[model samples]
Structure formats: C-alpha cells, structure tokens
Target: SFSGPVTDHAASDDCGVAILGAEPDKFWHDHKGAKVNAIRTRTLISKADIIVVRFGEKYRQWNAAFDAGMASALNIPLIVMHLDEHQHALKEVDAAALATTRTPEQVVQILTYVIKGTLPV
Candidate 1:
C-alpha cells in the first residue's frame, strides 16, 4: 500500500470523498481485510524496479530515511527529489548510488533514464 499523508487534492476523488472525515482507525480497519486478500498487491511492491521519492519541506529527513530504508530492503533503485536548498542532506545517503532530481518532471525523467539503463548512476 502507498502510505503517505492524505492531501487535499486526493479528498476530491471518488474514493477519498467516501472516506472523507472518517476516523483514521476506522478507515484502516475498513481497508485491512481487502488488503490482505489481494495477490497482485504483493507483486506491486516486489515488481517496482525503481522508487522515486519526493522530499518536500514538511518531512524531508523522515521521508528520505524512509525511502532509503525501503529501497535498501526491497533492493530497488531509489531516486530522491528535493529543492536545491536541501542538497546538503543528499550526502547522508549514498551520493553516487542515489539519483537526484530538482523538480517533479525531473523526477520522472530520472526514473525513465534509470529504467532505460541510461542514467549515469
């Protein structure tokens, strides 16, 4: 499952509209059963060859650490995108091993290159 803070934009969607204003625990319990029964769900995680993480201002350190851990555990390539102001923390992870992008479009471009095996690395 893709876990992240729900944004206002998501709340306007059909599924989100239904879950709007519901308690967090209630939502979790409601979805738990179906989440367990899906076979393709496991494949979703394992089949991801690359994980692109967007690190904005709110949770920079936490998101970066989480992405790093997930990438390491799953053995998938990880690309971290952040503002130029936060470039210093990029060294906290593997500089040469991680792909960096400064914008959302750049993140996509980086992932495309990585998937195509053309990224410098």
Candidate 2:
C-alpha cells in the first residue's frame, strides 16, 4: 500500500499497488539471495496486472531494466518513470511501455484512470 489515498482506491475496490523487491538482507551480492530475488521477480511479473519501473543512476544496480524486460515478455502493461536526462538511455524501454511518466503522482493518476475510468482532479 502507498499510504494516504492509495487506500481510498483500495477501499473503493479500484486499485492497489504492490511494491516488490528483495528484503534488506536479500542483497544481490549473495548467491542464495540473488536466486530468491529472481524467483520473486518472476512471480510478481507473472501475476501483476500492471508494472511500474522507476529508473535513475542509483537504480541501475536494481536491474529495473531487467524487470521491465520481464514485464514486456509477460505481456503485462508497463509504465516507466524517469527524467529527461535519462531519456536517451531508456528510450527503448519507454517504447515498450504503455506510458512513460515523470512523477509518482502521474503513475498513480494513470493507474487510477486505467482501472476506474476516473481521472485525477
């Protein structure tokens, strides 16, 4: 859950977001930890209705790009969030995305609209 009105969306039976990732102890440097993360990623991608990826310098290590690829391969709708500076590096991923947005709020608005047919005011 995303806190605040994210619950409102849930209460209305409109939408809910699951932020998936490794636990703090499951860092990728550990071999067993990496396997666990791979399973988690595969499971989430297989089950997700929509997947959102936010990219940046620090995010490169998180393999957001790899997750985005899985999202595409699974035919799940994808939304990529990144700034203009990174646009060149991410154009191909964005091309595969249903939408490329700038802010977290925009992602929420897009989700709300897609799932409920109600645009943010």
Pairs of residues clashing in candidate 1: none
**Alpha-carbon lDDT, every model:** 0.56, 0.71
Cα distance off (Å), candidate 1, residue 42: 9.0
Best by lDDT: 2
Give the clashing pairs for model 2.
Answer: none
Candidate 1 on 1-121: residue-level lDDT in tens? 2443334433322242264334357555445433432233345546666666667787446635665666657777767677887777666554634677788877756655755757544
TM-score of each predicted structure versus truth:
0.51, 0.73
Candidate 2 segments exceeding 4 Å error: 1-29, 60-62
For model 2, how does the per-residue alpha-carbon lDDT over 61-88 read when each residue is reduced to its tens digit?
A: 2478888998898899999999888899
Q: Find the 10 residues in a row with the least total lDDT in model 1.
A: 8-17
By TM-score, how accurate is candidate 2? 0.73
Cα displacement (angstroms), candidate 1, residue 53, comes to 0.7
Model 2 weakest 10-residue run by lDDT: 9-18
